[model samples]
Target: MEDPIFSPPLHRQRHQFVIDFIKRNKPQKVLDLGCSECTLLKQLRFHREMELLVGLDIDGATLKKKMHGLAPMSTDYLQPSDDQLRIELYQGSVTQRDARLRGFDLVTSIELIEHLTLADVERFSEVVFGYMAPVAVIVSTPNFEFNILFPGKTGFRHYDHKFEWSRAEFKSWALKVCLDYGYEVEFTGVGEPPPGQQESVGFCSQIGVFHRLGGRAVCNMMFCDDAEDEFSYTLLYSKNYPSLHDNNILQRVLVTEVLSGAEKLRRKWAEETNGERDAADTQAEGDWEERHRASEQHLEMEEKQTDVFLLVEIPSSEVEISVNQMDCKTLQQAEQQRGFWRSIRKLRKKICFGLMAEDNRSLGKCVSVPLAVLWSGCPKVRALGGSLSNLRQLLMDHPGVTLSQDGSAVLLNDQEHEEEYDDLEDSGYAEARQCSHSVEPEEDWDANV
Candidate 1:
């Protein structure tokens, strides 16, 4: 399907529900089944970390036609002119594509099965279930009751649809398939009838989630109904976390701890058992401790494997900032700090920190003045992050500060020069004057102030 300004009702509502599901549980891979023309695929903008999107359709020609219309994946010489929608669009019927479909974390069959023949339906169940990674599968089909209102209008059915069921009939069939196939079915999109429609035409859609014995749980479902009547429906299916205790990292951790503790108890029991053992079980006790110790150690390592840490780095600068504290002469760290603050003087974001002086003698002394203010009339801070002309404008804003001829130092309020920062120049026998460390506290140094 071409990217339409407005998505059909069923597809649009279904997309909203899927977006919400992704927000809560971000899956790494998504399989779109019977993805005709992939209209919704165009609108999806995943976070940079997302990987593995597969769009499957029964017709290779249709798939290529649609993908080419959108734009192909780009290489160095041939760039796609459209948005970088590098989806993996596979050509082949889902029933025939089992060899290509095995690892997806989510399999979404949206309003798809109704079009399949009964044989195709069974093949779909077997193939889709087999392809999933011991996880989950989502199946959605139109509600037959919904089809009643549009009788003979043929909405859910393409001229190709073989069968469509009403709400109860569909749910009954879902309940049977789930029970027989070990899937847990959930009904959705059913609600009060739209104001003036028949039960079949106005009734909402439904979805089901199937968990294979050894696969990850399925998490997405899309159901799209009629577009012309404005009564279409869409539904998304998201599974709650599954319980595979053997697969849970934390559970494995705790199990290892318990087994290690059990091994120790086993050793104590073995010693007791040995006192009464005959030759028959003597060899078992002889090697049991070593074996248990090794197993326990293995579990301990497994427990350690459960710990996860994530590190992310971005551009930032770290610098110390201080503020004068006159009331208490003792130097103290400020209790609060701003993560980001804008410096209008520099026209850039500045990382800020505040410290309260603790020494009574240093009370009322200016804490290290903010670089923004200290270099206010000078262009030093501003020029570092922007052009010289912009820096001159910034200097013009602050009246008293000035820069020396070489522009390496800043004169704060004309009292101190940037060269004053060079401690190495005065190292050889120059007695540094001790500025008065003693000063009275200013009245308003409290954090609230």
Candidate 2:
């Protein structure tokens, strides 16, 4: 039976190209670089004519699960297949040349080079050409210049791709590698270009085939003592930070101190304001009752007098005293009303303080105290009225007030106090200073004031 007709899709084209090349050359042994999960290797396995098929990858677990009946072997112990067709899986890095990689008839790395960092590309070139020195090498990569043809494609084909090369750039690098390694090279496209194009601008994918001129291989291929160190593992794109135990402790201490100070200031202000109101109320009530008793005695004297003139005079003074007492009583009631409102305001402030304290506790878990303080404009502390100025001064005089290497405030331990922090400069401090000016006591205090 003849081979099935494969579609001309970009991905299918790549596999077809490699299959055709393999069928024509009929290499005895073949190596596949970055053979993850053996997707392409499984396709290649259909051809039983090849005596040896070696799949190399960094992930041993993946190869074990994917490549059936292919036992894992140490890089040093890898041997070419003696049977009619044998598949071998070697867990290793292509960037590092191993002696086992030598004497291959063909080497194929499909869409692998773009995943490597620029620094690793040089090592990869040396390993494939200067070291393995296969009879033929085939490589494929995405054409970045042709990416515009696809709708809504923003960046590289894959997030893991460190860099993508244009057709011209790929040709330039491929030609240089062939020239340096004494190989004749050819380039081809895997996808059709846009319609109405007279010349070949580029392709969605680019392929290169390199044929060694004399099949002369270099020795040892830059022997690496740590050649066993694999580069085939997944790259972690996100940053990792050490646990924030120390920072958490520092934040807790700072928050505790701030809360304590704020409570004290609130208590002091409340006591002073309440005491004045209480004293005024006591004085007004006492004076009003005394005048009422005096008015009663005057009325009694007026009732005992027989002359109407004396009665009228005494009643007038009594009436005047009664009015004065009424005014004092009204003043006392006003003071009581003010006290009630003051208590209400204080209650609101207490509630706000509790909420702010909870916020501080949560903020401590994620950020250092000084950075949080600066970021939030010290809202909780500022809500302490006149105490805000004192807190600002305290922070300024604090020995631990230093900026981190990243310019955020660093909550230093006591031992780190003597260390110089001249390298730490924060432009944010200026913005923080401006923000602090706008930080007034919370609006709850307006009712009391």
Candidate 3:
């Protein structure tokens, strides 16, 4: 099906122009002002040029809903890359001064200025230019002069438009903005003109590109919000979900291996107990019954099992970390939990091994290392700093045991317990890896069929 976001050729044309402009400029950081429904921002998500994307809007509810709806799909095409593009959404007015909005390379406001009052327009220009101080800014608005071409059009194009400006009005405002903010401005138009009308005077929309004057070309700032209250702004989605067929296969294999191993161990212990009982019966007739009871108790104790719980923190959104508790009874159970972590690892490129501790004052204490030190998995990772030295040491001690090239399965080596796991290696264990990564969609894209 055609993407509903790209319908209506006017908006699509505007979005394409902005996207093309960004591609040419190759901005590392991009800010989308008044990102309603995130239609343009969604298209920009696929672009590899942007390292960080920030979308701000005054309608907090709409922004939240749109972000949630546009959450990444479970496709390999959307898999996280080495550079790891980060997308963030914020609920706030563009006319206001926000420290979070500062330090962007390019800021885009598409069909947004017409909704604002003239006073808000001046404030928006000041905040974007004087405070945020991006190297480049692109703004687009409806050209009232072109409205005459529409046969029945009367007043404003839309009910929400505070005002629309003619080409001359837009150019005059843009030039004054450039003069005030020490920026060089360029003018452009979108849409076809009437047969008799000049292209400049009859286009449907007007665009202005503002280039900042001499200063530092780049600046770095923390784009992720860490405050507990800021979690509402983050967008999260899970990918690489396991299918029912795959889950059924995995269940059958694990059950067969576990039951078989348990039965073998039980029989071996029973045989050893029988030999001892026979010897006791011959040596002492009175103690035979006592020894038999002790053997039965030992077997019963071996049958009982305890569950293990592990607290793991997974990267969820740009600004939030998802903490999950993994519950398992046996080694196989623990291994089953690897699928979730593997997906996260693939998206992030390198998985950071961290020490998770329970704390009374806070939610939990997590000491995580940087990605560079994490991938190397060396003892020198401790020197990088933070209270994560213990985690680095643990990783250094076990090399290539937990994390693998495919990041699907973890191998445990225990010489004493080799016999117990002999069946596991042969019982279709590698099949679990297949379920961890992207799988072909069950449905075909051919709508006609």
Candidate 4:
């Protein structure tokens, strides 16, 4: 994979250099110039922090063929997510000024300038630095000084290279570009130097990283009227992944996580209760009142069963404290499962969205999750300026979910009821539903596993 003279493949080293730069800077928008085969773009797509990614190249045929690799895979559809990473590809030369290419946070030209003729090289300098005016620019070229290390090589390293600048020549061009374009540059490169020539020569591929001067770092989106001429570049591919900011996508992702988590909690509580009734299963198919009373019976049975854990002679007040303590420990142990949320924390940590979700059959159909679990794993709801009230409203709107009378838990898979759930007339029924809502009331919602 590497050149005969290079130990670490030249292309791989260049890509790693760019990826590492991105990790440190965390740019939101990135544009790659001369993205042949788009291998870097493919790798960059995994970075969710980059909301907008665009790749440009003169090779239209190749760009069109390889860009589809950037599309969301099947698992992305199944297990919804909050991060909205959008990727686009265009067929155009880097020298041409496309309105869309301007204002990128990071612009990269890896081993590209050497392919252009001397005249086009000057145009590239003007277009990328003076016109596109990206906040930062990274340009790497073959180090002409390192060419002496290759035994049979002479003249330019590659057949297509119009010219390969030595370390001094590359620095001269980069410094001039910065001086004219209001940028400051730092020179660095990847790939090791020759065996005994560390100080004598630079890396096999020399790189120039330029940043815009203080106030010049902004992307002037309104740079000129030419920017409105959107046809300057042909868009080869475009895809916007699901984002929490988007209402429909957010609701689906949040509700799915909540419903699944709640179902697990209820099922787990039932199994450990040792023949205690399942509230959701025994819920009467008739009016809400019957379902409320049936749920009460289950709670009474659970309380009585757990009482066996305490001595028969305890006072009533002490007995209440003892039951509460036991219930808290039981729920704490159940929620300590493996990292579904670790990957799902979009605004919190960030979910890497490629794994298939568990099958619906295994999760079962008639699943209901308590509101506490739903509100805890609510999927960056607060990041979107939302509260529990807003989340409940979204779940209220979900087709498969039904909010119980007291707004305590969401019932799932039940047939749609036309009857208004506004407020019930019966006080006893409301209290029963409210009691069921407190299933794990004392557990901290903010602290998740």
Candidate 5:
């Protein structure tokens, strides 16, 4: 079922031409003119620059059967995206004028123009070049000039092809379309000619790249659903992919980033202050001292200056961003910092020395986290296996924490601090627990300390 002359198959080569075109011109909104089984649309979905990807085919049933592959993947939740993308499949003819198909950044028709009759081909030219007038258009069809290179091929390459055009004939029609529609055209082809046949034949498949002049195509058809009678396209599938712009995703990014940062900071602070003490604790020093000195006797008599740190865990509920809590510029920077897909590696620390630092500061024994900063932009708050909100509410319901009178901040009485944080004695928290060997996402703060 494959031709040796083309080497890599003409259809695949055709698709590659369009894919390269997309890479060169990162069009926000793109429409596939004759999307048969949506093979090209499936490949185009991976491009993050593609904001709106629409596939149009006359066969609704075939499209419905094939579009399942275009749905969001399960792995998307493990990793969230900031790119705004929407994919849609609609059943329609390129010959007919559909208001929804107007003003696209690019329009593509691969090996499809040959499938239409001579009359429909004229209509296709008018609808695509004159009516739907995208910024750029790519059309590929069989090059009749290359037929001589085929061994046993007699008629057109495919039975569905109405009339295959020679290189000259194809160029004549493309140049006429540009002249009639105020656009410029460039001719190119894929599937290199076999050895020693380059002079006679051009290529297995020919392509035309059309660019519209006079700036961008302006259309008033976005909301023009008034004439329902003329609309030929039937909506098949539509989905708004989860993006970082969403409050839920934003909260997740913020929560994960802050938690991860806080954990690293706490680890560094602990390592610097109690690196030797941590080794002692791991060597049964804590348990040994507890048994030997009866716990409080040794801590109060010799090791007393070191105090336990405080980390106020936020709620699990998706944070609704507020101006007081964080600004848009901060959120953008946070998103840019990760530069990775999904929360593969996060801090997720439930106990840190005051998680956020903004206008709020630690007062005395109580370390305060601004309620605003706590619910910072796109902060997805989770702790260990359990939720941060559940444990936070649990602590609040109990005598574990206290709130400021104005409710602007959450003052955690759990964190017992001295007048100064720097030059503090060996960390009591590190001395008691040692290094974070048992760092779990769902561990409760009360039990952790």
Candidate 6:
């Protein structure tokens, strides 16, 4: 097995290039071909929104162990927990094994293709390109000519490898494959081809970026002889990607990569921290007020929203608010929702409301309204919007407040409360509104997952 840990400086350069390339594609479901120990996937996993991450390797036992350790870290793109990003690993050879994988946004074969025979390469490409999700396929192999740079560091080309191609040979083969499969191919360098002849510049390990056309395979066959004959080469596969917003491809790629990476890190950290947390530990940790303030600060930092509209139905209420189309309170409730925190879109300000009244007893059964709406008179007092007899009494003595029941709902129609919220937002006090009380210990952490 090749030691990725000791990867030569050149190989590391190639690996980084591939990582950046994949990040550009923004794949949802990723198939990691010839995944050894899955370190690359683990690192890359945190930088993107992943749906299903499947790792394939010939070593079943190692793959199993890796998967077990990762299972608890897996989560929905919106609610990734440490345990939910568990990668599914399969043991099988690329040539002899069938992944039955289709619709993958990206397929990667890093330093794995060099070990195959001509027949094996054909089979490997067929399966990879056939099932690829029209977005991108990245295949990297040792640049045979550049092996001169490392005297004793030739790849797995002993008796196991049928043949290895120079950069030009690999590019030629790639071109033929792309032509037959209908994929557009681009070449990327791994490690700089040590300063040498002009042609040697492209002589490092060859990375073929295969872009599937409309989800269809393009190339049928690429001959080694043909690759040897071609002269012109292009960097079509240079790292670039489309953005939902207008920006240069490189800028969008960087921004998206950072955003996804940050999210993945938070999820990974949360998973690690959440697993070991205990009631006593949390109780004994930091000052309650300070931690609460920190949590609120964290929340505010994440308050920036995406353009996409999210509809969240309050657990007990029939009302579902479109975070983009809601009142401030609804937006606040949306903010408190778990998914809302993970998404970084600017929410549209339209909120949808629904009223649920099963009977007189269930009038104010909603749990989200109280915390979302502030009572003006008492900064601490929040109206849950129900005419509970107990609440009515609390407000009656607390003049300048009205808990008047309107139909089946009790409106915490306090002018002072509204005024304060207005003032808070207008004067930019909202950002300064530090939580006055300690955030309750997350009693629901272990209970939720």
Q: How displaced is residue 233 in candidate 6, in Å?
A: 37
Q: Name the 10 consecutive residues with the lowest summed lDDT in model 3.
A: 349-358
lDDT of 5 by residue, 33-99 (tens): 7788899998888887889999999888899899998988876665767688899999888889887
TM-scores, all candidates, are 0.41, 0.44, 0.50, 0.67, 0.63, 0.45
What is the alpha-carbon lDDT of model 4 when measured against the actual structure? 0.67
Task: Give the winner by TM-score: 2 or 6.
Answer: 6
**Model 2 stretches astray by more than 4 angstroms:** 1-8, 69-83, 198-200, 216-449
Candidate rank order under TM-score: 4, 5, 3, 6, 2, 1
Q: Across residues 81-160, which tens digit of lDDT does each residue of candidate 2 receive?
A: 22255566778777876766676888999999998988899899998987777888999998887767666768887889
> What local lDDT does model 2 show for residue 173?
91
Candidate that beats the other on lDDT, 1 or 5, i.e. the better one:
5
lDDT: which is higher, 2 or 6? 2
lDDT of 3 at 277: 52
The Cα error of candidate 6 at residue 180, in Å, is: 2.0
The lDDT for every candidate, in the order shown, is 0.44, 0.58, 0.58, 0.67, 0.65, 0.49
Alpha carbon lDDT at 430, candidate 1 = 20
For this target, which candidate reaches the highest TM-score against the unseen true structure? 4
The total number of steric clashes, by the backbone 3 Å criterion, in model 2 comes to: 0
- Kindly give the number of clashing pairs for every candidate: 31, 0, 0, 3, 15, 39
Model 3 misses residue 367 by how many Å?
37
Candidate 1: segments with Cα more than 4 A from true spot: 1-8, 45-49, 69-86, 151-156, 190-192, 195-202, 211-449
Stretches of candidate 6 exceeding 4 Å from the true structure: 1-11, 73-86, 96-100, 131-134, 152-160, 196-198, 201-203, 215-449
CA lDDT, candidate 6, residue 171: 77
